[model samples]
Target chain A: MKKFEHEVIFCIVNAGFSDAVMDAAREFGARGGTVIRARGTANMEAEKLFGITVQPEKELVMILVKSAIKEDILHALYRAVGLNTPGQGIAFSMPVDQVVGLSEAPIEPKAEEQAE
Target chain B: MSEAITKKEKTPIRARAARAPRGSKRIEQVTAPHKLKLLFTIVNRQKAELYADLLQAYDVNMQMFLSAQGTASTEMLQYLGLGDDEKVVIASIIREDLAADALHMLEEKFRTIKNGKGIAYTVPMSGTIGVAVYQFLCNHRGDRV
Candidate 1:
């Protein structure tokens, strides 16, 4: 059965590379994306924490892709942007329940196996 | 000199009904504090800048804009904390027609329908203070003299 769903791909990465990231997304089946500057959080412990400055240089990218093409797009991004590599960035997707405007076709999900 | 105390204000006189509704007793009239206010919100900080730019390009006047973290998920079932991603909120009080135009511009430019980059929503306000402030906001884009 076909179902309607949304794919949300967003991540924060090193700054000054928004152009590159957008280019990669277009190559990965995304029509367009937006980038914003941001700062990473401080997660270090208090006592052991030395005065190392966490880089405030960060860019956030969000791309909406078809659910069927999500995996392909993610893999393409990972390969192109060194996402899985150190200091490259982090990216993930969650199902968007409802939206207006950029709605798209639904995809069929695999059938579950019945226990005998 | 002691000012004379005015007699308790008499009940205001009702105006003669020029055009009465046919038979029906119900009266429909727009009330005071009916000005429309719009709150445009976006979570993606990047899209925020673009939106602001688009508004500027369109010469849309903005009354006020505020930036802050989103608190929508604070009471969610999961303790899912709010991420460090900051949200930019733009608020403007405009005439109803202008608000509609602003919404159209947002849809045309931002494409909020698409996935995660950002989403924009608007809410209406009932009223505002000061004619001077109102005039200033209405002409904020510098397009209107």
Candidate 2:
């Protein structure tokens, strides 16, 4: 039998949208995600373009899941957050060469005593 | 509530300093004849933004980033059991002085310190393509036009 492969998706978004993005990710099939604060570098141009203040405040979220579910999770993020929209966010997945803790033996059910 | 208000009012100077424009000379100052490689990571997959932020602090005109998967020791792999994850590598040219500050920030902020979480590092840049490109990278963000 061929061994199964696992993939993980990592994403970083403006901090303001972290919750919404992560929530949608979990809804799709992601077990969980880690969120971290970050700052944006290119956004400095916003000050020149629009006189409005732009905060580089950013949040990064990483999710690990089976490669089979990559498309579903990506779509879920697109629909929920709309990466096309400014500050909405982006998502992508990479193949995992080696995985640990993913292989576990199945557990047997306890025998039941039936009285006729 | 009163205590919370007092804490908010007493915000540290460093927090306030972080909000201001990083030195406008970051671009020019960082590139002005320096021998340092601006090492960065794209494991989080936010290149453009991260680069932009760096430019605000240093004058890194030219940079190259490579996609890489995060790798861990077999023991760490088994202990943490990160199923399938990879780390990305981003390397750029920067001045020696700017490289030190960048490394400092990376150590204090990006790396796993008190929390023991994510991690990254930087190395000194040794060689380069040409002087013109080197100057351009350092001169882009100089306060003077």
- The prediction achieving the highest lDDT against the true structure is 2
TM-score of structure candidate 2: 0.37
The iRMS of model 2 comes to 12.7
Local accuracy of candidate 2 as per-residue lDDT tens digits, B82-110? 54444434555566667666655554444
Poorest stretch of ten by lDDT in candidate 2 chain A: A101-110
Over the stretch A1-116, how does candidate 1's per-residue lDDT look in tens digits? 42545576776677765556666666655665545567777556732377655556787776656678788777766776665544477778755433334534433232352332
Docking class of 2: incorrect
Q: What is the lDDT of residue B47 in candidate 1?
A: 59
Clashes of each: 1, 17
**Proportion of native contacts in model 1?**
0.02
Candidate 2: regions farther than 4 A off: A1-4, A50-53, A84-87, A102-116, B1-145
Displacement of the residue B75 alpha carbon in candidate 2, Å? 31
* Lowest summed lDDT window (length 10), candidate 1 chain B: B7-16
